[model samples]
Each structure stands twice: as structure tokens, then as C-alpha cells.
Target chain A: MQKEVMFAGFGGQGILLSAKLLAHAAMNQGAEVMWIPSYGPEMRGGTAYCTVIVSDRLIGSPIVKNPTHLVAMNRPSLEKFAPVVKSDGVVMINSSLIPVRSGRDDVDELIVPANDAAIEVGSVRCANIIAVAAFAARSKMVDLEILRECVKSQFASKAKLIPLNMAAFDKGLELAEGK
Target chain B: MAKVLMKGNEAIGEAAIRAGCLNYFAYPITPQSEVAEYLAKRLPEAGGTFVQGESEVAVGYMIFGAAACGERVMTTSSSPGVSLMSEAISYIAGARCPAVFVNIMRGGPGLGGILPSQGDYFQATKGGGHGDYHMLVMAPDGVQEAVEMTMQAFPLAEKYRGPVMIMGDGMIGQMMEPVEFPEDLYVPPTNKDEWATNGMDTRKSDTKNIVKSLYLDPTVLNDHNLLLKSQYDRMKEEEVRFENYNTDGDYQALIVSYGTMSRVCKTAIDEMKAQGLEIGMVRPKTLFPFPEKAIHDAASKPGCKVVVSIEMSMGQMVEDVERVVKGKTPVQWYGQCGGEVPTPQKVMEHIQSLLNS
Candidate 1:
């Protein structure tokens, strides 16, 4: 009933936004959740990261040193956080860019070619959505339908982008299910 | 009444508006700037006013001015910014104005890292500013508690006719969680006709009201100090709130903490408990009231061997714990400062070391 996820990537890669999408979906499902972002200078360019904790019970200490899930969008993130994930946890790596594997044997590793899948869906920016969708499909932690609804509302101000992002998400979900 | 996920800072701002906060003036600072940002837009809709003051110092005075006029006013800042407002805070204290200030503290003595820290424990619980005074300080561990504390702060400030503070760390300020504002918090505004300076016409008297902290006579100042001291004592008696967890049976150690750090300790206590080392925890909800008696009682438990003060500072709240324990129990301090929050594992290690030693 409790899940802690650490999502890490480059500054502009939509790591924080993807986490928000997950948080919004979780809220709709009546789960308690907390999304805490690293509010420092890495936000301008270096490595960006955020911690998302979704629990059925009250969440304690949003800062998770060891997470149950880690979505690493790049190599450095995977190398840094992969080892720290709790045993039997899930680690989703953006294999298109990471080009490295989680060395740990205890965790369930999912290597999704997120960037390549995003290219198939039309925009590189959609890679985060794709990776998170793959994560959702692999874990089944949140409903994909609810996730799509969250995505639609999140981009309600820009209606034109919904179809493209949805396509990206579906593609990611399909690929992740195949794996 | 529906629950919505909100950032901690944004929720605090909304709670203020729901509590009928009429004026907000604060400068932008990391970790807490979201509070001002959220208010900048929402305050207008709530029929309230918002001002991005030129600096923290200026914003402090603006809050003082609004509070002096008997309006529900609030401002928020991080460590260094709070330091800048200490001078005005002191003056507001001396003048006996009811205002709310929130410190989403960051690590500090200087422009330290913009991460959650309890380093301001001394600055907040003790006197941040000079001149014998205290601001009623409330510490919240999570976003929901943050909202509730903020809503309660307005009435507490009004009742005391003195400043009240909501203290949290950057983690609490930046995190997002589901919360629902109580319908009653959106109650009608408080009456400010009594002590406020709403022009001479509003008072309907010949004498004009002057708001100043200066008292030329030492005897008069002494009287003012005594009044403030008495109010503080009253607060201690009536407002001391704390939560004791898993302390029913004999426990090997007692952990004392507040704000976000307390939750971290709770997690560590669970781990220690599973290891057959019974660790009880006392979390203070109101820091200024100190919960001295509760702490003393917890430390006086039959099996309690030591009281550990867990903080995000070098060691500050430990002093209060030590003072209250009065050597009744061995008081220990463990912390990580300058943006490094201690993980439960780290805390358990500290606890285990204490148990062994």
C-alpha cells in the first residue's frame, strides 16, 4: 500500500511533470501521495530529480533515501540511484540513452527504449511520458485509463498536444507490455 | 470540501485566505517563495491583498503595519530572509501586534543551502529577535498539518494580540499532498474595531492611537515585559500539544523531535521497535509552548534510559530537552545539517549507537 519512487533525469526532460501526472492520478484514486522536487540550481540545467511517495496510510518523511521505484532517464541517474533501490524494487531505465544496466541482481529491472519510442510518437519531449507509461504498465500500480485522464487535464490549456502525448504514452505502454 | 493534491507552500497560502487573512507581504526566497507566489494570485480572489516587498526587512514592516491596523496579515521566508526580518519582528513584538509569520527554514547561519533544515530551532523557539519576547511557534510535520496549523494561527494571533509563527522546513514547503480545507476555516472575518487604527472616525474618540515599540520609562517597559511574560506562561499552560507514540509499555529510549524531522524519527522508531529495542517518541506540535511537562513525563518513564534529540541542526532543540530533563535522563543529540536530511537508516544507526553506549 506504500510506494516511494525517485524520478531523475536532465533538467528539461519532464521528470517533475511526469511525477506530477502520477500524483494527480493517484489523488483521483483516493491515495495519499507526496511529490517533493529538488528545488536547487540543478533545475537550471544539470541533473534534476524528484521523490514521489504514494501511500494508503499517512506518508512519513517525504525524503526517501531508498526508494521502491526509480525512473532513471539518463545514465548518471541510473548509475547513482540503481544500487540504492530496496531489494525486490523496480528500476525503469531509459535504455535508449542510458546504454547501461542496473548492476544489482535483486531488483526487477525494466529497460525501456524511451527516447526511441518517443521519436516514433513524433516528439523527443514525450520521452518522459513514454517512460512513465511503460513504468505504469510494468508495475500496474496506477490505472492507465486514469493516467490518460490526468494527462488530458494536465494539458487542457494546450488541447492540441494531447493527442500526440497520448500516442506517446500508448506506444510506451504497448512496448513495455511486450517486454 | 473535496480533497486536492497541493504543494505545501501553496496549501499554506490558501489556508491563510480561508482563515480570512487580509494582507500578505513577503519577499521571494528559495523553498518558501511558493507561498508568496501562491498568495499573489489567490489573495486577490479571496478579497485580500498581496505585496512582494522590496526586501525581507521591508516585508516585515509591511506585515507589522497591516497587523497594527488590526488586519489578519502573514508573511513567509526561509532562514537568511527570516534573519533579515528579525529586527522588525522584535519591534512588532514590543508593539504587541498580532501577525503570522512562517519560516520554511533552510540550513543556515548564512545563506546556506535551500534544503529543509531545523537549524532555526534556536532562532524560532528562543528569541530570534532581541527584547524579552516570544512568538507562538507551531511546527507541522506534513502538508495536511501545515494547512490546519496555518488556519488555527489567525485566531491564536488575535487572541494573544501578539505574533504567531508556523515553522516548517523546506521539505514541508516543497512537498505536495492531498488536503481539504475545513469549511469553517472560511468563516467570516474577525472584528478589528477595538484596537485597530482605522482612522479617528472609526474609533469615535478624541484620542488618536499611536503604534510604537519605544517606551521612554524603564518602569513602563518592565510592566510591558511582565505582561508578555504572563501571556507566554498562559500559552504554556493552555496550548502545549504533543503526540506520544508507542509509549504504552516500558521503552528503552525516548525520542524528542518536531517539524519534519519528527516524522523521520518516527520511521526510525518503527525500525528500532522491530529489532526488539523499544523506542518511544514524543513529537511537539507547538514548539514555543515547549511541551516541557510532556517531555519530562516521557523521559521519566520506567524503562526510558536516554532521551535523544533528533534535529536537522547541529544541536539546538536538544538544549531545551536537556533543560527539561534536568539530568533526570541522559540527553543525547544527533543531527545532519546543511541540506542533508537523516534517513531512517541513519537515524537507527544513531539510536543503536546510543543504546550500545
Candidate 2:
């Protein structure tokens, strides 16, 4: 089986980083993974997106017309990508920024207040971590423990941000599990 | 070694290092600039020299100079940058120096766009530079293959005593995938004392080695061209590499594609197989010294009705496919250019319509 997860948001929201973290986690777990970024003429608030494809078998195509999941960190991202997500796939909406729903009944929609969660955890930058954690928890695509370790190492160079990001991760898991 | 997830551009840089190529010169371009960025930091750690030239034109000559001295050398660039470097490539080919040139292709003609494109098919296979010279071109479908091809290109260049090119699309440069560098593939630089100006005293000989591409005498230039032709002929006999998919079955149509375009074709083939349509594909790993016999035999298969050359360009490789097939079967071209990769669904639809008609 193959699952493609698209992360879309503003440039500084760490969309590419979170997607890369997820791909790294999947690779560490012995799964074939590909992380494809939308590159070219990108600005801070303009728009940015990336796609992570995880698979059991060798992956063939990096381009996906419809991904299995969507993590929309902003209203534009939600509006742009939510329509193409497959039925029964998870569509996680950052309710903190997006006000509308996906309006699809067949798929799993998880409302994640990622920005608020990141603010509560002491840094708004960790909102991407929150959304990624919540999506991973709900989708169960990768081992949560492995994902946590990957996140830890991603911030290992930074050192001090580890605790804050870990708190954000746990809160995301808690919120996702509660749902 | 442990598997690491890395972007294709950075992996190629590390692969060159693994192959013991210490000298690198390049100018930054989108989708492929990461290679220069990567080597700038890593080459020093490996006791190698990394220089970013003032422009791509200068970078080309830098590679030529290093290779003429028998140093393992390389440069990475996009389509337009490669255009500026073509003159040097021809000079290097004429001088018989070994070098590696990697083109992480983007949209073309001019500065089209910074997205994945295979529009350089003709340019790579049919001599981007002047004269009857061709760089041994290899197109990789994914990051792992890109790493392997980059590592292998050094030895291949040395073996043929000419330039080798690793032709990849922007997606191959930007995408990150898991890759492992096998220790067995590393080859130490070959002995170039015979032709390289590594110095007469260093070789303990009174004779000096001179490297030049200018042949003023007509007969001597003809002989030089013939010598280069012989090497290319040998490559056609030995260096042609390709991969077959679903060809064992009596497929109705044959697809010829390369690089990232072939991967999408594979997906389309898989989907078609599920729907009981037995389509096959011949993916050329080496664009130059292309698999002529393989394509001919696949096209001549009794059940094959049509052969399609699917590419990112409108119809470049199709001309080669037509030449190879020789009218045994109808050949068609299908593609999208300017950074828009054709989807598997669209490919399947087009093939299904072709078969029906």
C-alpha cells in the first residue's frame, strides 16, 4: 500500500520541514519514502507546499494527482488541496487559520488548532510540529515513537527548542487521541 | 553504510566524492544549485577543491582544465547554463579529457521555468556542442539511481577518455529519497600519465605530454574524428543500458521513455495491467548508445500494435524511436513541456484511446 501526504501552508510555517521529518521517519522505519517540494519563486507569505509519499513497495511516480491525505496550515492551502484528497483519507485542517470546513462526508476531517497549540506550547513556529503530530497520530501511517525521535533529532542542533517542541508534539497527540 | 534520506542534488555531490572525484567547479542554478552548495561544505572536509566560477561558461573550461590534467572533475548546471558550457564540452571531447557534466534539466529554449523537464533529450543525445561529438548521457529515474549513475560516471568517463553526462529533471534534483552508498563502487582515479600533463619529471620521463584539440592538418583531424568514432562505436556495443517492464507478456502497445518520465509511465502500465490491458515499456537508462536492438525487438513483437515515445518534450525521442523501429509499427509521440509532467492517468487515457482506434 502507498500513502501520499501533502503539507501546504505559508513559507515560514515549516511545511517542507515537517513533511521532510515525516519522510525521514518513514525511511527510518524501512519504508520507501519520497519527499517532493514545490520549488520556485517562493516568498514568506505567498504560498508553499510539499508532498511526502510513503510506501511498502518501490515507489513509481513522484507526482500524485490526488494524495491520500492533506495537512492544510492555511485557508488558501485548505481551499486548494482539500478537494483533491481521496475519499476515506484524512484531511487535517488548521482551524486556527482556516474558518471553513472541507464539506466532504466520506473523508476523515480532524480540526487541529495548531497555531493555538503552538502558542500554548510557547512558540508559534512549532505549529507545524503540532499539525504533523496530529496527522501522524490520527492516520497511524508511522509509529508515533519513531516520529517523536525523528522530531527530537531534527531539533537536536538547536538543543533548547527540544522541550518546547516535544510539549507541542504531546499536546497534538493528546488532542488527536481525544478525537 | 546506513540509508539516509537526501535530496538528489546533494546525493549526487556526495556520490561524486564517494567515487573519489575531489575537484568540483560549478555556478549555481535552480534545482541543481544544491549540488554546488553541498560540495562547498563537504569537499573541503574530504580534502578536495570546490570552486564556484564567475559564470557557467568559465565553469565549463574549469572542468576541461582539471580533466585535461587527469583530475577527476565535474560541474552541475541547468539547461541554459549548460548551453553556455557546450563550447567547452566540445573542446574537452576533442581533447579526449575525462570529465562529468550533470544537467538537472528545467524548461527550455531560453530561461523557460525552474521545473522538471526532459526537454534536453535532443540536446543530450544529439550533441549540444558543435562537431560530431556526443557525451555519454545517462538519465536516472529517481534519487537512488541518480546516486548510482553519478558514482559510475567517473569510471565510465575514464574508460572512454571523454566526457559523461548525468541527465536528470528538476524533480530528480529537488526530491528527497532514501539512498545508500555502497563501498564497492568506489574506483580510484585511473593512471593518466600517458596523456595528462601531470609533468615529465613526476613520471620520470624526458618526454612531455601536450593536450590540445586543435588539429591543423586535415588528415590528422580526420584520424582524430575516426578515433573518437571508434570509441563511440565501442560504447554502442558495450555501454548501452536499459530496463524492461511487462515486456515478457504479449503487450499490445510499447512505451519508450526515460528518466522521471519513465517512472510515471510505469505507474500507468501498472494501472493498465490491473484493468487487463497488457502494455509494456522500454526505459532507456543510457540516452546515448541507446538500446536500439531492444526497442526494435519490442516494437516488432507480434502482438504490439503501436509504439509511443512518451517524454516531457513534445516529440524529441520519438524521432529516435521511429528511426529504430523502422516503420515495423506505427510510432507516436505524447508529452507535456515547460515543467508540467504528464500524469499517469492522462497517459493511460491516451494509450487506451490509441488502442481502441
Candidate 3:
């Protein structure tokens, strides 16, 4: 089985990092994974996105026209990528920034106030962590433990931020579970 | 070593290091700047030399200079940057200095967009610079292959004593994949003392070692050209590398593709297989040798009617494909050059139409 997830937002929204973390997690689980960033001439406020493809077998194509999941960190990303997601796939909406729904009744729509939750937990910088955690929890594409370990190691370079990110992770999971 | 997730550009830099190449000179250009960015930090850590040249032209000569001294040297650039380096590449090729060049190709005729493209196919396999010299070129489909090719390129370059290029698109440079570098792939630079300009005292030779491309004398220049042609002929005979997918039984169509574009075609072939349609593919790993025998043999299959060249450029490699097939089967070309990769669905549709025709 193959699953492709697209993480998209403005350039400074940590979109590429979130995708990389998920891809790393999937790779650690022995799945073939490819993380492709849209390395166009993106400025600070311009659109930036990346796709992470995980497969049981060798991944033939790194490019995915229709992803199995979309982690839209902003309204434009949601509006742009929502229509292209395959039916019955998971679409995560960052409710703090994006106010509209995916408007698709066939797929599972995940609504999480990632930015607000990150702010509540500690800093808004951890919003991507929150979004990915909630998405991983809702989608179950990867083990939550593996995803959590990936998150920790991602911030291993900055040890002080681990606790805040862990709190954000918990909050995201809690929010996704509707608690 | 354990597997690690790495961007193709970064992995390429590391691979060069693993191959014991100690010198790197390059100018940064997107979609491939990461190689220079990576080696700038890592090369120093490995007790190597890293120089960010003032320009790609200078970078090319930097490579030429180090290589002339028999040092394992390399440089990475994109399309326009590589264009600027072509002069030096020609000089290095004429002088028979072993060097590695990584072109993480971007779009264009001029200063086009910084996106993945196979637009440099003609320039790479055909001669980018003047004269009748071909850089031994390899096109890698993915990051793992990129690493292996980058590591192996050093030895291949030394073996040929000519420039060896790793031709990848911007996608290969930017994409991240898990890679475990093969152990024992590093072959130390060999046979350089005989001709390398490493000083007479160093080699303990009576004659001075001079590296030059100047052969103004007609008879002498013709002999040199013939010698180069003979080496290229040897390469064509010995170094042809390609992969055949699903070509075992009777297949209706044959695909000729390379680099990242081949991967998309593979996906299309796989999806079509489930629908009871069979298509086979020949992915050329070495673009220089052109995989002539492989293409000819694949196209010669009794069931194969039409051969298609799917590339990211506007029918560049298709020329080589058509030449190799030599009218045995009808050759078709489908591609895009504006940096938008042709999708697998589109490829499938094209092949389906071709079969119907």
C-alpha cells in the first residue's frame, strides 16, 4: 500500500519540516518514503509546500497529483489542495488560520486549532508539530509512538524545546480525539 | 552504517567524501545549491578542501586545476552555471584529467526557472562544449541511486581519465529519501602518477609531466582525436548500463526514459498492468553510452509496435532513441519543457492512444 501526504502553507509556516518529520518516521518504520519539497522561488510570505510518500514497496513516482492526505496550514493551501485529494482520504484543516471546511462529504475532515493550541501550549512555532501529531493520530498511517519519537528527535538539536513540543503533541492528540 | 534520511544533493556531497575525494569547488545555483551548502560544512570536518568559486567558470577551472594535479576533484552546478563551466569542461576533457561534475538540472534556454528538467540531455550526452568530446554521463532516478552514482563516478572518471557527470533533475536534488551507502565502494585514485603534473621529483620521472589541450599540429591533433574516439568506443562497448522492467513476455509498447521521468513512466506502466495492459520500459542509467544495444533489442521484440521516449524536456533524448531504434518500430515522443513534469496519468493516456493507433 502507498500513502501520500501533502503539507502546505506559507514559506515560514514550517511546512517542509513537518513533512520531513513524518517521512523520517515512516522510513524508521521500514517503509520506503520520499519527501519532496516544492523548491521554487518562494519568498517568506509565499506559498511553500512539500509531499511525503510512504509505500510498502519501492516508490515508483515521487510526484503525486492527488495525495491521500492534506495537512493544510492555511486557507489558500486548503482551497488549492482540497479538491485534488482522493475521496475517503483525510484532510486536516488548521482551524485557527483556515476558517472554511473542505466542503467534501466523502472524506474524513479533521479540524484542529493547531496555531491556537501551540500558543496555548507554549509558542506558535510548534503549530506544525501540533498539526502533524493530530493528522497522524486521526489518519493512523504511522504509529503514534513512532511519530512521537520522531518529534522528540526532530527537536533533539534544541533540547529545551522538547517539553513544549511534547505538550503540543498531547494537546493535538487530545483535540483530534475530541477531548 | 545505518540508514539515514538525506536530501539527494546532501547525499551526493557525502558520497563524494566517502569515495575519498578531498577537493570540492562550486558556485551555488538552485535546485542544487545544497550540495555546496552541505560540503562547505562537511568537507572541512573530513579534513578536505572546499572553495566557493567566484563564478561557475572559475569553479570549473578549479576542478580542472586540482584534477590536473591528480587530485580527486568535483563541482556541482545547475543549467546556466554548467553552461558557464562548459569551456573548462572542454579543456579538462582534452587534457584527459579525471573529474566529477554534478548537474542538478534546472529549466532552460536562458535564465529559465529553477525547477527540475532534463533539458540538458543534448548538452550532456552530446558535447556541451566544443570539439568531439563526450563527458561520461549517468542519470540517476532516485536519491539512493544518486548516492551510489556519485560515489562510483570518482572511480569511473579516474578510469576514463575524463570528466564524468551525474545528470539529475531538480527533483532528485531536492527530494529526501532513506539511503544506506554501500561499504567498500571507494576506489582510490589510480594510475595518475604516470601523467599527472605532480612534479618530476614526486613521480621520480626523468621527463616533465605537462597537462595541456593544445595540439596545433594537424597530424598530432588527428591522432589525439582518434585516441579519444577509441576510448569512447571502448566506453560504448563496456560501460552501457540500463534497466529493463516487465520486458520478459510480449509487451505492446516500449518506453525509453531516464532519471526521474522514468520513475513516473514506471508508475504508469504499473497502473496500466492492473488494467490488463502490458507495457515495458528501458531506463538508461548511463546516458553517455546511450544503451544502444538495449534499446535496439527491446524495440526488436515481436510484440512491441511503438516505442515512446518520455522525458521532461522537449524531445531531446528522443533523438537518441529514434537513432537507436532505426525504424524497426515507430518511435513517438511525449514531453514538457516548462519544468512541469508530465504526469503518469497523462503518460498512460498517451500510451493508450498510441496502442489504439
CA-based DockQ, model 3: 0.85
Considering only chain A, what is the TM-score of each predicted structure? 0.96, 0.96, 0.97
Q: Score the docking of each candidate (DockQ).
A: 0.76, 0.86, 0.85
Give the total clashing residue pairs for model 1: 0
Candidate 1 residues lying further than 4 Å off, grouped into runs, are A41-45, B186-191, B200-208
Give the alpha carbon lDDT tens digit for every residue of B132-210 in model 3: 8998999999999999999999999988889999999999999999998997788877688878998776685567788
lDDT of 1 by residue, B76-159 (tens): 999999999999999988888889999999978799888889999888878889989999999999999999999999888877
Which residue pairs collide in model 3, if any?
none
Per-residue alpha-carbon lDDT of model 2 for A67-165, expressed as tens digits?
999999999999988899999999999999999999889899999999998999899999999999999999999999999999999999999999999
lDDT leaderboard ranking: 2, 3, 1
- List CA RMSD, all candidates: 1.8, 1.2, 1.1
- Stretches of model 2 off by over 4 angstroms after superposition: A41-45, B204-206
